[model samples]
Target chain A: MQQLPREESLRLLGSVPLGRLVFTQNALPAIRPVNHVLDGENIVVRLNDGATLTSIAPPAGEAGLVVAYEADAIDPHTRLGWSVIVTGYARLVADPSQVARYEELLRPWVAQTMNGVLRIQPDLVTGFRLVAQPAVAVCAAGGEGR
Target chain B: MQQLPREESLRLLGSVPLGRLVFTQNALPAIRPVNHVLDGENIVVRLNDGATLTSIAPPAGEAGLVVAYEADAIDPHTRLGWSVIVTGYARLVADPSQVARYEELLRPWVAQTMNGVLRIQPDLVTGFRLVAQPAVAVCAAGGEGR
Candidate 1:
């Protein structure tokens, strides 16, 4: 495995539309799979009124809620791909025009009504890529060096 | 989207070997991608010494650490698949014989020394499946007579 640079990591993160959102629920960790759109360095997602996340997300002017977002694309058979994790503060979008723009940009995966928009300003971005073993190293380990 | 039964959820979870582990770090949520094996109702994963998870996992004979495990198989194109989330307590496997058994059963995906093993006893198992709209519903919405 190899570490990915911040720029490369963000690029990979933007390539995927779906990711898991992690937060503290009842003083314990909770995860929910959600669809997101990368807006520059910030990640934006839509939530419904029924979602607990919507209630927990900090409102416009208040301090943002700390959360983690993770996404990856690994082949089930090959197990070779990249994974990215972004830790940041999430806040509810209060601007009506901005919310309209995000609505035009991101389409929720589910059919439920999504009235809440969240913007996460990432503080740390980390990623890793899984690669196959080098053939030369494998050959050396097998004592079949060329 | 449809809610999945507990049995079905576990079945889908076991079908995938890779999942994201969610835990708390410095009072903020953190996530990591790891390979796991489902042993009955419990989930087992291997971690290297450098992994903070190993340090946080409760030792044997102590109360388990609260964490969440999530696994899914969703197609990027169609965006249709099942996702499973298991929130529970995690504990380090202290039994040498059990550790050896897990080591033989689950081969670590990364080429790293995985000296620690964690077992999570799920307290809550929830899952959802994203299914295509039924033909009848689509026809009704489109006002096209079939």
Candidate 2:
């Protein structure tokens, strides 16, 4: 696997609109696939106010919660692709103007009412790609495996 | 969204060969997509010996680390599907027979060598489905603001 640079990793992240958000819920980890938009370096996502995440969110005016966001573009057929991970702090976007702006830009995948907007400020970004090995290629083409 | 029963949840989990495993590294959350198989109620997975997960594995003959495993089958076009989450303890499978059995059943997507087998003993299983709402269906068929 090849490690992607920070800039490249962010670029790959922005290129995809779908990703998974991993956070802690009651001391256990939870993951949810969400639609997101890039706001400079921050990731903006719409969360349903009555959703599990909103219910589990830390109180307002508190320090942001640490979370991890992951996106991948692996081909289901070949299972070869790149995956990017972002570890950062997440908090509700309380600024009305910013929230309004994101509301017009990002659309929730589900039909539920989304009354909460959260932003993630990344501290670490990492990515890796799976490259097919030469030996595997040769063997797949009837070389040494034969 | 409709809540799925435990039996249906496990069935959906077993139906998928790929899922993300969420764990903690340095007090921060980490996620990785891995191939797995079902051993009754236990979720079995293979990790490369030199992989990051293996490096963080607790010492052999100890209680497994608590982790979360999530899998979903969401349709990209409709953005509707079922998601299953299993919170459990992850430990290296020291039993050679169990390791060998999993090796024959599950194949790693990458060409890297897999020398460790880990089993997750689920403590809690949760799953839900995103159902198409009537408003969404009507709006999609030219109802709202038309």
Candidate 3:
């Protein structure tokens, strides 16, 4: 199994058309897929229509927010896999001009109402890898082989 | 098109096999998914592997740690969706005896590791939806469209 470097990982995330965004609510964790674009060290996303808009819209103030972006090719050949996760806090784009700029660059896959532009202001970004490794032998607990 | 009621949305989240956990890291947002179990009003999650484990492992003195979680589903045909978001503190399960009790209920579909267990202690939980409404009008300022 080969490990993906941090730079490559960022590149994959920036370029990917679709990635999963994970957030927390109450005590459980949640994840949703959305279109993302990389700007400098930040990531821009647009939530067109769904529950996401409600949370980011009015009522929900500037409190704790977490957004994760993930993308990977689990299997290119013989279909195996790998998955990387990026977790961070995200804020809604207040400036219409900035929102419009990103809207032009990144388009939403979903076509419907409740559509609005939101940005994830990432704080602590951590990543991981899942590469298939060759089978290695492990000693049986009792050493009893039939 | 159909909308998922608050109760049903939560149930759907509980039923899913995997979900991404999003939270803030040093003011920046972060996200990762861990195997979780739904315990009625509160959602119990176990984080003992990969990005999630490394990020939110609570310190000894800390009893409550803030975090957020989200999950949803999209139907292509209907263009309708529903989601639930939970915000709360996540703490590590310390009691050696009780730890086993929580771990027993958690089931991992793919990767499972045993470094430590994390439980998201909910502070606030809410939900929302994105319903599709008919367009009032369409204006075509192009050459081909009539």
The best candidate by DockQ is 1
What TM-score, over all chains together, does every model reach? 0.90, 0.85, 0.58
TM-score of chain A of each: 0.88, 0.86, 0.70
For candidate 1 chain B, the 10 contiguous residues with the lowest summed lDDT are B136-145
**Residue-wise lDDT of candidate 2 within A1-146, one digit each (tens)?**
78899888888889877788998777767777787888889987888643676665553476788999988877655667888999988888778888889976776667778888888888999898877776445533444433
Could you give the interface RMSD of candidate 2 in angstroms?
2.8
In model 3, how large is the Cα lDDT of residue A19? 66
Worst 10 residues of 2 chain B by lDDT: B137-146
Which digits, one per residue and each the tens of the lDDT, describe model 1 over residues B56-76?
887878988999999998766
Local error of candidate 3 at residue A131 (angstroms) = 4.0
Instruction: State the C-alpha lDDT per candidate.
Output: 0.84, 0.79, 0.56
Per-residue CA lDDT of model 3 for B52-115, tens digit only, reads 4446557435856666766555443343465566666777777877678776665432333555
lDDT of 2 by residue, B79-136 (tens): 6788898988888877777778887777667777787888898898999887888654
Per-residue error (Å), model 1, residue A78: 1.4
Candidate 2: C-alpha RMSD to true structure equals 3.3
Give the Å shift of residue A53 in candidate 1.
2.2
Model 2 clash pairs are none
User: How would you encode candidate 1's per-residue C-alpha lDDT over A15-97 as one tens digit per residue?
Assistant: 98899889998899988888889999999988765367667887878988999999899876667799999998999998999
Ranking by TM-score: 1, 2, 3
